[model samples]
Target: MGVFYRAPEPGAKPFVAEGDLITRGQQVAIIEAMKLMIPVEADASGRVLEILVADGTPVEHGQPLLTVATGDADRAGPGR
Candidate 1:
């Protein structure tokens, strides 16, 4: 199974999705809500497999922002 990223708000403007693997510090996407620009982050170290949102599209909270295939997904604890 892969990890999925979800939007944090409902009917919010979508940001640009950078389908690039982010080891620790990387900008994945942005969420524009109430004229505020919020950056979405990648939570794990892996390759970015899919981006589920289009630029300027309205996104909902808990929506799948992207999917990542982390090699440590089967681990019992956080990735080291």
Candidate 2:
């Protein structure tokens, strides 16, 4: 429902880059609309395979921000 931003602000480092390992609920990007910064987080723990959105780009609701390669532990379920 807002614009997707890979970085917190222009010229700043992105929250996550390709090949980076991320855990569930980890902030990967932000969505800004009406001056509100909404954090976009990972749904599962995994290695980042790709970033589907560019920094400061506009995005729609349900749009993918990136692709992640889920780890075995993630696929096997929690507490593995």
Candidate 3:
């Protein structure tokens, strides 16, 4: 229900990247819909393995934006 909007500028560093370790509740990216910006956060702590979605792409609810190598499978949460 939203479009994935990453990085504030064309060459700005992304909030997170592959091989980057992130903790629970860390800001990952932003979703823009109706001109409002929504922040995406991590649900678990782990190393980011990959980014599943590209910037400026539309994403659905519960869509995974990235993958994390967490200790617990049930806790793996890179995005909603």
Candidate 4:
């Protein structure tokens, strides 16, 4: 597990948010583990439906950090 950050640094824009369009390999969050900061990215392009983890919170392995609606449609359900 590691501390999660929406924005890696202070004063930086959030990586992702609700209703935001995201692309493949887009950095969505940051995980700080063992004093190292790692980025979490999206596997597919889609619109961000929801954020599952709060900023600065600890996240476990295989945790669902957020939900995305894939494809050109605006479907933000459980499909993704």
> Which segments of model 1 are wrong by more than 4 Å?
1-19, 73-80
- Every model's TM-score: 0.61, 0.86, 0.85, 0.84
lDDT string, candidate 1, 45-80, tens digits: 666676765555677766776666666643222111
lDDT tens readout by residue for model 4, 8-56? 6987899777999887778888899999998887877788898988889
Per lDDT, the best of the predicted structures is 3
lDDT of each: 0.54, 0.80, 0.82, 0.80
Per-residue lDDT of candidate 2, residues 4-63 (tens digit): 888888889998999998898889988998889988888888888889877777888888
The predicted structure with the larger TM-score, 2 or 4, is 2
lDDT of residue 1 for candidate 3: 90
So what's the TM-score on candidate 2? 0.86
Candidate 2 C-alpha RMSD relative to the actual structure: 4.2
Residue 70's lDDT in candidate 3: 82
Off by over 4 Å in 4: 72-80
Greater TM-score among 1 and 2 belongs to: 2
Better of 2 and 3 by TM-score: 2
Alpha carbon deviation, residue 31, candidate 4 (Å): 0.4
Question: What's model 2's lDDT at 47?
Answer: 85
Over 4 Å off, model 2: 76-80
